[model samples]
Target: MNGVENNLDIKTYDIPTDSDPVHDNPIISNILLSRGIVDRKQADLGLASLSHYDTLPDIKKAVKIISLAIEHNKNILIIGDYDADGATSTSVAVMGLQRLGAKNVRWLIPARLTMGYGLNNNLLEQIYQKKPNLIITVDNGISATETCQTLSEEGIEVIITDHHLPPETLPNATAIVNPKLAENEFALSNLSGVGVMFYVLIALRAYLSEQKILTQKINLADLLSLVAIGTLADLVPMDKNNRILVHNGLLKIKNQQCPMGVLQICQIANINPADINSVDIGFKIAPNINAAGRIHQMDVAVECLISSNYETCNKKAHELKKLNNQRKITSSKMKDEAESQLIGIKKILNSHHDLFGICLYDESWHEGIIGIIAGKICEQMNLPVIIFTNSYDDNILRGSARSTHKINLKNMLDNFYQIHKDKILKYGGHAMAAGLSIKKDFLTEFSLLFNQECGKLLKNKSLKKEILTDGQLNPVNRNPIFVRNLQEVMPWGMGLAEPVFYDDFIVLSYKILQNKFTKMFIKDKNGSSTWNVIYFGGVIDTKKGDEITIVYKLSINNFYNKPDVQLIVQNYTLK
Candidate 1:
């Protein structure tokens, strides 16, 4: 069911009047300039070096602490979150430390079902049992002020490397390395948790080399594949620095220079590592790895990342794939339930227009899959959504929030907290996504307040689904060579979105594929070319001879050794 009506609008970019090196094709030039790329130099910024690592806040301090720990042969335990970014960061820290000749390096990931997130008091007890002299947290711990203080008071040094936005009161850790802490805007926006950890390792390597402490040679570049996967999967904006990291990592994957586990994951996903792109990592590899953290235990994913044996990695990859399949099944059922609940809520509220946000709860819903369900509901409804389920604690309900780009979810939650301070137990996250917990008793009030806040925040804002298009496709440039060249230039994610163009087409014929996808032949209204288009996940309502305005991205469908030009339909409207 559609929650909010959407208005379709095509955007046009201003032509650059400066003497810039433009693309040979005007379509490509417009796409690049629309994304704020003015010239070839700006486009080439993805080739920037990792030297910017030195500029990150507290990098040197983190390196010093890690080096001292390694030299002293102290037991170092890494605390990581359960998501893919945390998994990759854990793997990078464990492997990087071992390669640097650290005698003992172990990692602990909080089970999403049990210990909850970050370095909580409960998780601290688990870490205390390990008797670690130092604690290195990756991908989390930025908000654990009390936990950090407790660890410090216990004489355990802590290094926090996280990418999440920090709170007002900083944790008293030995060193905190986060790009968001950078003074400049450029450094503050891009790096993911894995990127932060990678920088720490880079600084550590440099420090070790300068001190002549390195016993064996280690190439940090070998870990770029993991970095790439984590960065893409984390959904961070693909700024220049992030692009450079992803580009290099994709190259490593293409050259078969990544870890055995990564290669095995690619194999299990039916992807050729040599031909994989950022999209493959996000849609295929990341989800499989993330499934372990969500449905089972994160250690399975961490083990898969750190394993050096191809057989062992392949085995773990299979396990992860199974978990992912289970996760999908669970998420699908939850989505159906949530949609039904939403319809009920709409009736109760009396008007669909009143629903600026949706809050749903189900005791039977799997808490691990609620976030995915929330995201799916948010996308389908075109409204901010929060899905709640039973938490480990009987008295508390855990919820995950997903919102449109216009809404700052974390900030919204913060505003709610200001009014209903006693209701929300705890919450954290970024602009588009967040997680929270509240007393079960307050769920009703909290839900009402949440909806009201969303209404007040989004007053007068249209809830229409906006399909941003790069003007219209030039029929002359719609060919295999043009699409191939576009794909070769760069990877796309977050801020650097994949180019989507819209144009009128005459539907020639259509056939249902596998009862799920729709395969159609459509001729451009502007040209005589007949293009094959595939619409996945859903089918269009139009039939043969229907003229429709279609939004799609140019794609190459490689079957066997032959590559054919195909349009992957994003959205369409009857003309």
Candidate 2:
């Protein structure tokens, strides 16, 4: 490692780096240091100002089209994708339109199974019937060249706000607001669909202000929380720009004044308003919202995000929770079946054990849950896994890909696309995860080609699975006062991981709690206070009097309204 030690010895390890003394006041510095942002400048950049949210590279072209739409009172319809980024982008379009004083702004999100991904002909018909003057796309239009052309033929202008890689042929929309476009000079090219849409709204707001059309009272910053939600939920890398958006959004959420609907969803999920971190949005809220669109209509989810009335918000929140529960049950059944089927494939199992990838397909598997199953398999085996499902409809197949430490799945897929472009229908995603479709008959050939393609990409086996610890913790920093303070400063995600600490400790007492959890009380030799630790999964290997190094995260466990700070063990190694 460049700046830090890679050894696992806890006593000899000091956190690889120290927090900046002057700018990163001790507490903030500790948090930054925990995340590997030890430099003062890096911390400042992460906590950058809203002023940095400027005109995107395509602002002038996109703004020109949007200004024309507003001037002519165009009937605009936004076509969005089905995931968190899509939903958030849809909400942004709807809310931003209302804020811009535009009427007849509607959104259409295709069902994951029926209409398929991206802008399809079926959704085009629905939008065309409304006789929209313009059809804008959020999170999906970059790859829909044919669909955009069809809309253009119907005398409708198209403005695309997406963050996916452009295929060989670009969509002939009025303008594209994507940071990845070759024409784009935007500093952050990895903006999510919602982030791209928010940039358009930023440009729109600038246009409206320049036109002196501030007939309505609105602060664009009020929507930062929503942008943050969409960006984080989509799992975009928390680069400098995204970090600013998330940081500001967390500030809004901390103030307890985010979207009433989102607030209601959080309350229903039992997520404390104060402790709403990136994981909460990604794991808890995004899934619920996506569940609605996956198996049913997205109108309910959209309504949940836009509803201002507490009763409606609460009602939708409960409905979304029910839908999410149902989704979990359905997905669990599907996952179990998929895993069992994979077990039956002796050749596949043996291949997976020896190779760096796993690809399994069963015609009976449900498409909605294959992605989840693929992700689970990836984490379990530490290899890239792709799970495929044959859809009920003719000649359609969908699959999800998840990767481990060594491979960037998206980049690898890009290479695969270049080779098998004719076989692929549409595909776009990030480094760790991706979704793609192909004809059912080509399933065997595609799998062979995919493996051949990945063979060249994932050849290394020495990518060690090492946990990077933030070194020793300050004894004074783990008490009630400091731990409580840390809780309020959360909602951390990708670029900002929560604080983790490690130390050599002697296990004092150990007990099994509720069978599934291991509870421990331990102390180190440095006079550090005794700590309570909880471990999920199987039994711990250590016994009382056994010395081990513990890697854990500090958390304030709320028990019956009593606030107690505790350590949650992630991993342990025998001394």
Candidate 3:
């Protein structure tokens, strides 16, 4: 274990003051001020959140495409992604159209390890087996020019709805509804894949309503809860538009009338539905849905989500729990082996570069766990990371890239693809994260090329990771009132982050409990500040009597029927 502890001057932050006139409430004001929300209306908007139903752009175009598909009685196959957003988007598109009296709609999600991501000609062939009249791709297909071209050549109409960054050349589909297609045009460019699909559904619903083909039995607002889950889970930028969708979704979850699957997930996570937020989705809901896709079939998750039957939903929830547990164990084992292999890379140990970027591949490693491992390493090492693994039966090498503030992983992947087009089989992603598949034998070549690329682009100053804090606060204010207010404003994820507070504390006592967690009792000068810090898996390098600066989120800990406030430590350093 490596432990570094020393007393150092605490770094101060430019904490927003009450006089800043940004917000009237101290808690909301502090939170908004941290994110540059200086105006009262902006704060209110952020807190209230928006909806896809309220802000569906290009409604006329979207509705026209759906109505054409319906009138033609085309076989519409909803092509989805393997993650939560994709699953929810697929569900929404299929159900929404089916509700609109379209009986021929079907759904398909490419196997992550086999066909890979996006709507491709090969995937179209798979869908063609069903002999559908039309194909609607959700959460993907923006970059699928060749696939869409093939569909068009075969006299198949394609409607693409996606939120991923589009390539320089757009696909010539029957109709395309991508918010990021052009800058400064769409107000909700930050929507998730599911959110985009939801917009299409909203337009379709409106057209059906006008035609008197459907009843008002199902309100689009009812589906916002799913949209919220997908949006928050996908980690889309929580800008104004996304915040509204998520905020309203939380309101539904809090009301406990969501699909049985969501309620079951909430119960399994022990999160109060009425109090759910973005963290709960990220830490609780999304992980389980993703685990199914990573380790098994995503269809299990999708089925669970769409099932209204309580027994089936409960069973699906339990299965997700079991798979998530297996995923946790698999990730830990793989990370250990990965680190063991990295020990020989002297450059990493010497700290020659301040930022640690990793790319490791083993045909023996399970492909499903690589992305989880990449994210875990990024969090643990505070650096951008890319984890590669090979398929046991195929020559294809696949990888998932995650990033920190220092470097943009998506841009890195994009640039690499541009230069090594011949070597890259496929690659596309958003700004902070991405996925790629390449020839297995080219692993060494890609790593060396990526290293050279980083050397040319990254500066030494960009190596160190920095933590942003809202500000310091008196320990006395860490009471129920403050915690409750924070909870009310929660469902925080991605762009709109959960607030983290920093303060100096003297370690009164410390111990490694359960051989995993590091528990510390700490207080500030004059004993005015006191708190208990629990760091999960923090036992590796910690000791008693250490003065430290800690960054943490406030959470209520209920164990053994005792209720108390707990600090979920994000990072810490010697004071």
Using TM-score, give the best candidate's number: 1
What lDDT is reached at residue 200 by model 1? 85
Error of 2 at 172 (Å): 0.7
What is the Cα-based lDDT of residue 516 in candidate 2?
A: 43
- Give a tens-digit lDDT track for model 1, residues 1-575: 43112255555555566646457777777777777777776666343544467778998988998899999999999999899999999999999888887899999999888887878887977898999999999999898999999999999999999988888999999998877786677654578899889888878988998899985667988799899999999989887678888888998899999888899889889887777888788889999999999999999988988999888898999999999999988887887788789889878876655888788999999988999988878876668999999888888999999999878998888887887778788887878889999999998888887788889878887666787778787776787788877775666888888888888999999997755467899998867989999876455666899898878888777788687888987777777
lDDT of each: 0.84, 0.73, 0.74
For model 2, what is the alpha-carbon lDDT of residue 558? Answer: 74
How many residue pairs in model 1 have overlapping backbones? 2
The CA lDDT at 350 in model 1 is: 67
**What ordering of candidates by lDDT runs from best to worst?**
1, 3, 2
lDDT of 2 by residue, 91-183 (tens): 888888777878778888888777877687778667767788988889988888888888888788988888887888998888877777756
Mark the regions of model 3 whose C-alpha exceeds 4 Å error after superposition. Answer: 1-23, 45-58, 68-74, 183-185, 215-217, 347-356, 392-396, 410-425, 439-441, 452-462, 511-516, 528-530, 560-562
Instruction: Identify the superior model by lDDT, candidate 1 or candidate 3.
Output: 1
Cα lDDT, model 3, residue 76: 78
Q: What is the lDDT of candidate 2?
A: 0.73
Candidates arranged by TM-score, highest first: 1, 3, 2
